[model samples]
Target: MPFKPSRRHLHTATYVDNKLYILSGFDDSIGIKGIAGIAGKQFFYLDVSVPFNTQEILWHDLTNINLVPSHIGAGSVKGGTNNNTIVLCGGRYLANAENKASVYTFDTRSNSWSIPTIIGESYIRRRRDLTAIINDDGKIYLFGGSLIGYNIVVNDMLILDTINLSWGKSSTLNAPIPRVYYGADLLPNQTIIYIGGETFVNQSLTLNEVYMYDTINDNWSTKKTSGSIPSNRAGLSAVLGLDGQRVIIFGGYRNNRIISAQDSLYTLNINTFEWTIPKIFGNIPGPRCLHKANLIGNYMVISFGMGYQQSESDILLLDISNNDEYKWVINFNPPISSSSPTSPTSPSSPTQIFAQKSAAAIIGIVIGSLISSILLTVGIFFLYKWTKNRRIQKNETSTSDNYNLQRTSVITATNNYNQSSQGVISTTLTNNKVYNHGRENEEIMKIHDNEDNPINDENIISEVTEIKNHGQESISVNNNQSSSIQNINNINNIDNNVVQYLKDEMIQVVRQEVNQLINSDNSNNNY
Candidate 1:
């Protein structure tokens, strides 16, 4: 009786090698003067095989052997190669705060405590009221905890490989709501079922809504459960049944009162997620909340909780060997499964792994498509600007070429006019003969630079020649006629304006001669 554990709640009980190993917990109320709650130092267990009736029913106190750190509300998972290991981490408050998430491990075989070397980045040190479960591969999955400060994070699913001793995060999306004070356990396949928890707001949420976490693929989903769902509860303990297919749920904090006298026992089928109450008989334990339950062979042994009118050191066992007839028992005949019921993580389990990875691949494809579209838009914008600039440059070059060609055409026309001056080109002449040029003619002097000059410094003799030849094209015919205009008036039926060269004296002489020829045609119809 000297080794018996005092009245305590928030302690941890883990089954290892047929022994119920009980660890640190809080003795007083957690809310007594802020964070001033007494942490229990006693660490012991009862070899469940021999208990109560025999002298062998005694607590093996390992309290004085090696000083174990006191912790309250710490998450502990039973694991290891031989399955005699308990990995404990985080708490409402740990006595040793320096290396909070060093993740202490206890070997029940040697009864030793040691911190394994962590390989990679763990991100956060410690958290309170977090849920932890170890898979068959010895990887501990930590999720849903209360944060210590801004630095200490337990937010995303944290993973710790117990074998290699490495730390990492799941980085999984669509996680469950952040909660505390919940009971979580593996359900047959590496699929974990977590139920009965409170939010950060201190409001007790309904236990009807449960979430299944797939540890293999790192994802969370809500499994459809039917048949008499439990009410809103907290401080409830959910232990996997001895049958290995159902979760046995027991006493919880219900409607402002602790479930003490009136016992609550329900069975949730892990495969179907359906809840069913098994028949009960024979002195069910009364007035307990925030307790830990472990299935040993044919009995459901619950220990260490806030219980009234009962010795904390006393044993409470419910015999569940008979499927429908579950009665309280002091001792068990033989333990059901050799393996821990909580450790459902086996070699072939969790079929939910592959489907989630396919979804991740789809997300990756969408991200790649978005990046490609951005690059395409940028390329098209640059190409359009380049085309517009090139077109403007081409237009300017074309205008320059046209100007050069027009100037070259005007120069060629002026040279042709000088060459054709010798021939009496029969063409009409008028005051509208000036060429309308769009550009400034820098070579205007070229027009006046012709070899055959239209006018010299002084030349009135050429004007007389033009007046004497006005009557006829032949000089002999017009020489006798002194008055060249009078003979030209006798001519008829002639309407031709002919220019020999640019040497037509001031143009007035030619105009007057032409007027005389027109008057002759009108005056005398007869030639």
Candidate 2:
């Protein structure tokens, strides 16, 4: 039982739950162009759980539940907290009319589609052939796409907050050149990596540069890749590996008319920024462009695309579970009806042979350069760490010196206070002792002549009592001075400890920033 979709292109497919939803695209078989090109209104889905050869392998049409008109090249994303919702926005339906900025949503749980009210003051322009990626924060990011009616590509980045059902332009700076039909994939670190796309500049040349958008920081950076670089192409399909460490790019068109529907497959290691063509066994799909690749478990399912001679309806699968080897299998082949187009023969020309050899050489060079770059990056990182550590040590030393100075000042103040209080106590004690001795002598002599000197004895006794009270006050002042000196020493010690703790915290923060910088650098290289 062969299941096939109508010959179409410029469509979008998204995998949700266990099904792949194939949306509107231009159907050349219909040969009908009203305002826009011949576009299909039917919505089809396939149960991926069933084997491809099984009779159950068929696409179920859900167009009755869909209300929106047919469209092509719409930006879509599967988002929401549960990832059960698919939102499509901004596509072209009629060539003469303005591009559709209307937003539509499909609930996977209910199998229903509905238009959602967009609430925002910012004008959301209608675009087609745009790329949209969903972040972990439930926001869909739309990148460069063409303004259909105007025939202009825009570089504006828009963000749709799913939680609020609102749209706003992102404040990302230094974005890539405005282009369409680019290959894009999101990394685990919330960065969107965009590969080659066709730009209108220089008479519509394909771009080979790689650009990365940091979703967290709202910044863009260019990555320089070394290796057998793939030819500048657009309409390529990129799928991230299950481990989230590699991106596999397949089938794209090189010049305006040249389609790269061959056996060549490129794999990029995100960690090392390396590209390698893995040896694939079994039947390989023909060269094609504008295809969709979906990673399901250990298998990669590539759907319909424009092949070398005609539009392809076959589903190709590549088993990547084995790291050492890959097995390619054609999962589904559509039934050959009279309406099916015949496959054209692909001849290998001398130019093609030379191109292949050149590509191989480039791959060799890229591998060599990638290794060197990795080594250099590692070395630079270690050097940076060493420099940071040295700086931290110097800062700690300076802080310690400051702490010692502060402690010394506090100790000096305490010593001065102690000396002054001791001097005052000594003077008061001497005066009290001298006065008490004189009074005591006088009182003792008066006691001998008690009958004649009663009034003199009483005066001497009062003077002696007053001297003793003065001595007690002097002792109390000395005790207070000792306690104050102890407190000053304690405070000085606490201040020193606080300074040390602050220095440590500063060093920790510096280390953290350095680590973040290194990680960012590594990620950019992969982009």
Candidate 3:
């Protein structure tokens, strides 16, 4: 009980149900079957709920207790939705056939290990050394890392639904390219932040991009970052701040060396997407990489990682937590508990009432605003349609009336026309006419329609020809012209009696056309 797990770099640890569960990692150790030397039952847990000093702290070693077969680490670690299960997925193989066993879980309640019956994990064996996180909905999201048995990093993202015990691939829009050894942390808003990592070429190179994933919408986004941002590096460690609005990142490898402690400490404001070198005052921990930082309240518990040979950079066992009073301590303290009274006699305070009322008001405002927006949009759309129809009708009426009225001048010398107010009309004619034989006069008549000619309005019926006569020229003149031409005694003039008969026949034709037009207009209006 006095001894602790061996110092290791590539191990995995996470807090669940007030217990910190540790998993397998790489160290100076031998392996079985020529597999991972870092693989073994290097797994353990510490009850952080109980108070203890570092000197007397007990590490519950699960190394021998119902040993998990193919126990491996440096994979993704997340607490289950049930809140008691710790899930580990994708890591260096501890067994020769570790491909068949991609998942290993530990049940704290049963004090036992298990490999949950999963359904969709067929190519999951190929995924290795990836980072994992669980959202409130119990979905485990795994991101960038090297593929199993291969040195190249992958660009793939896989999701494990903890509720259904199934695996699926993420179809992300604009996801980040393949990389590995990056630092990642999940925000309370179900967003994941991926910090600097490296991708392989002839050798590994730093990936400076900051990738953000929105789990709700299944999209990836990158935003502009400002402030004193740290230089791009990989193999760093990131932990969410206790405030739930920021993330603190620690040392990583950069420029072929561990980043110095002086430039190692930085904070990212999740709300603002800004970075800053936080002020610290104490024995600063040495520069390191591939480490893990766990936030326990006001202090960050930084674990083991690789370091430089300089004495200042030789050790990384320090608490850079508060960023205000940085220190190296062997003390473990319980977080201050704020317990509310559960007495039945306890009355609700004014503050609580006000908060409830304020919440109700905000919700009401949001719902009301949404409904109003929809109604306003609908109203505008319908109004536009109605106005368009009305305009169309008015144009059609104007065109019919204008051309119809102008046509009166073509038919008679007095130039008179009449109709009802509607677009379809009934016309009355005032008869007055005079004609001279010396003048060459012709009139073109056309009927207009409401088609796509609102500007020039050329949508018209074929032109009507002015009547002229050589064999029947007598009917071509007006009534007075016809009467006056009958007295003329010329060799070209037709017999007087024949001219009279022709004039009478022409009048009859004119009368029939007028009656037909009036009937057509009446029929249109009725229709």
Candidate 4:
């Protein structure tokens, strides 16, 4: 609800105690010559719980703290003993330097950052744009990200025990290929689900495979998911629903010939491994990549990112209290093309209309049958009760089953009012077995990989603010290199390809819907 942070991408935002904190990132507006400047030292936060229109929402800047120059692809998490601290992991500094394997923690209570500590063995290279997740045990898991300067992507898994303050490598068999800029989320089962990310083999390749890692067994397995899979893209935001049964995936950039951002929303049912695109109502945010999404209560908050036409500062909220449908709302509407089709709108084509009708008919039939069964059962129950009362008073006897039922009812009545009144339906059903926290912790690990440019040959400093002026100068040198310029060109070409790919996918989806509608119509005519 506060004034949005400066326009940037590759930044991380986490919600803690109803407050949102945004870390350093890249701001294209501060480019040196023709190269973009990385805003690593800037930090800001807002009290998200404040009503939007009541008070003037203002961003509180805390950029004066000494911080490492790690902007792009940095991994961050908020989970300490108090759950008030934020931990930032590996990332690059500048173009000439290597990726950092350092770790830093920010204490909200003290309003200070801990000294940077190098993580892992000397042989382990620093990485950026990696994903990180913290389990109930407070251990952070680091996953795939790229090495600085080199095109190498590391697939090795690393674990940082926050309690002991030590790093250990996870020996996982059959891990996914090394990647960067991928989307990841921790499931209720304690397993981590990794989605799309890009890797460099001979050249840059985007991946679509789903990789699942079992923290308990320290093993990896590829899941065969059904339904319409989304196109391969990097920097997508994935968040586990409050119920932890479903995961919501939002916008990301598809690197092809041209960089194109996606605006669609997809959901994955963890139990069934089925992906579905639900119709969202309200104002939808435009296509963007490198944004952050966090699950707070029943709302999925989408923060800053780079849009298709420009950078964005708006926040989008996707309400997931109801799995049957979704509602999208944004904090503010930034100026974009009026012709853009990213706004939330119902599917209105003939095919979509027919599908809706068919679904409604099926639901109506099921409801009618349920009501009929309930009425019949009630009638029989009343008749039996009357008959029993008429003749069973002398023969009536106390039974253990009846006593148990009475006890259960008494217990339910006593505890019902104590349950959470957040208006959200509990994902865990009454019939489901409750799991202990220790067992859930043993089931999963969190892994993160991100990318950042390392600063030239300078000693990694205790005072990170000293290198703030060096960022622009380093970008100027990077811009002069022939190879660097060529790489930039290649990235632009990939973006073009992304746009074309999105267009083709849209056309294909429309065609498939039409065919399904035609088939349904034919079947009805035959009947």
Question: Each candidate: what lDDT?
Answer: 0.62, 0.64, 0.61, 0.62
Off by over 4 Å in 1: 29-36, 51-57, 94-101, 150-155, 260-263, 311-314, 334-527
lDDT of 4 at 278: 76
Error of 2 at 162 (Å): 0.5
**Candidate 2 segments whose C-alpha is farther than 4 A from its true place:** 1-4, 31-36, 54-56, 95-101, 201-208, 308-313, 331-527
How many clashing residue pairs appear in each of the predictions shown?
3, 6, 0, 34
| Candidate 1: residue pairs that collide | 260-287, 297-335, 297-336
lDDT at position 230, candidate 2: 74
TM-score of every model versus the real structure: 0.59, 0.59, 0.58, 0.58
lDDT of candidate 3 vs native?
A: 0.61
lDDT of 4 at 12: 76
Better of 1 and 2 by lDDT: 2
lDDT of 2 by residue, 1-527 (tens): 44456756667788776677888777746652223356877688876654565223467778777666788778777875567777887778843433244678898888887777778824776788877788888888889888766888888898888888888877657887788888888999999888887876523333334788888988898776655567777878888887788888888776664454453478777776677777788866577777677776677777666653343344667888776667886554322221212221236866667545643543344334434543444454346435644654464455446556765787687766554322232212222121225543543211122343222313221111121213322223243345533443454355445434544553344335434543543444345
After TM-score superposition, the amount by which residue 135's alpha carbon in candidate 3 deviates from its true location, in angstroms, is 0.7
lDDT tens digits, residues 96-168, model 3? 6533567778777777877787887665754664577888888888886777676777777888888898888
